[model samples]
Target: MGSAALFFFLEPDNALLSDVNGDLVNAFTAVRDHPIAVHNRLKKLPTGSDSYYKTRAVDPDELPPLDAAARFIYLNRFCFNGLYRTNTAGKFNVPYSPSKTGRIPSREKLIEVSQKLQGKRILQADYAKILGSHVRRSDFIYLDPPYAVENRRIFKQYGPHVFGSSDMEELASCLEKIDAKEASFLLSYAYSREALDLFGGWTTHRVYAQRNIAGFVKHRRRACELLVTNIC
Candidate 1:
């Protein structure tokens, strides 16, 4: 649920939002349940290399839900390229991004998001389990799994257990199950041979997007993405 951008765009009345990132899920919950508290906490955070590193050094688990959520938002806003890469020890090691303005989302925005998230089920669970248990006929599912190109090294942002080629196979199987259940779904993935092979015979469209995961602008490039859907 990288940003859950599509979900915000659609804004359906009923939905189940799930991601494998527990911190992200907790942040979303905090925002939904205590937007004012989170916003107040965020307002107290100072923005600078010293402040950023000091906040990063503190374990989010040691803080309350609102503080943890605020810390997550602050780090995400100031981290390198806005990436969430962690070291082998599961420590968020993304360096400070001087380019970022170090501005947190507005209180109004958090309240608006909180309203949108109300009555929606948010959970930190595997995609397969969420898809298997919650999907039903006529449901519209949007899948944006982590980039997993075969025989290539990409930024591993989701920690050591990042999605890999094997997980892509499981995602394909999940797609098949969704198709069998007669639910319409769309999948956005990096345009690669593995993606093509796994999701062939679907309505696929190629699209270009700016790659920002690179730590420097010089390394950024235009990347092709595949939009595979099963809607008539």
Candidate 2:
């Protein structure tokens, strides 16, 4: 959600957006194509724990596309830290946080975002499938894969799949191909010595950042991540 804001701010001429979480695609599409329906439905859902839990139980496929998208937005805007973690059963289990308000995008904002998406292709596919051999030197790819958490205690792992160290190597190999084709690229990941060693030859930097994890400014602390690129 944070990364996707770049497009909103910059208003890119074009983009090919995708994510492994297919529900997000549905929500974005709904907001793009049926803003009024989603907006009206979102207003009717009770902004409470029971509503949150019940909405989570509704299978996305069972609901109307517009409702499914509203469900996704409702859960996301109403969850703790806006986290997208799910249980082993693939059920969204992020408990209701006392901090969050049950807010959904308004119709006008949805219309604006939808308009921006007009010329784009929103997909639910793997990175490699999206970045095929058709890349050209004029292309610039920005990838945000799972962070390279060094220790089990240092970070919270989420999702059905684990992107271990081997996956990092695989990504490096993939980036090598992109670089070979003369396409520029950048990636964000956990800042670690291994990441530096893994991508030594490419330009790299440590970016200091912060996240409001506890719904308070005082709880925000210094954080950093690696910004590695193969762009000249």
| Per-residue accuracy of model 1 over 50-168 as CA lDDT, tens digit each | 99999999988898888999999999999887877778878788889857546799999999999999999899998998998999999999998888786545636678787977798
- Model 2 spans with C-alpha error above 4 angstroms: 1-3, 152-157, 213-220
Superposed by TM-score, candidate 2 places the C-alpha of residue 87 at a distance from the truth, in angstroms, of 1.0
| Candidate 1 structure lDDT | 0.87
Q: Judged by lDDT, which candidate is best?
A: 1
TM-scores of the models, in the given order? 0.94, 0.89
**What's the TM for model 1?**
0.94
Clashing pairs in model 2? none
Name the 10 consecutive residues with the lowest summed lDDT in model 2. 152-161
Q: Which ten residues in a row have the lowest lDDT in candidate 1?
A: 150-159
Q: Put down candidate 2 lDDT per residue, 54-138, tens digits, no spaces.
A: 8888888888888888888888888887767766666777778636555777778878877887877677777776777346776
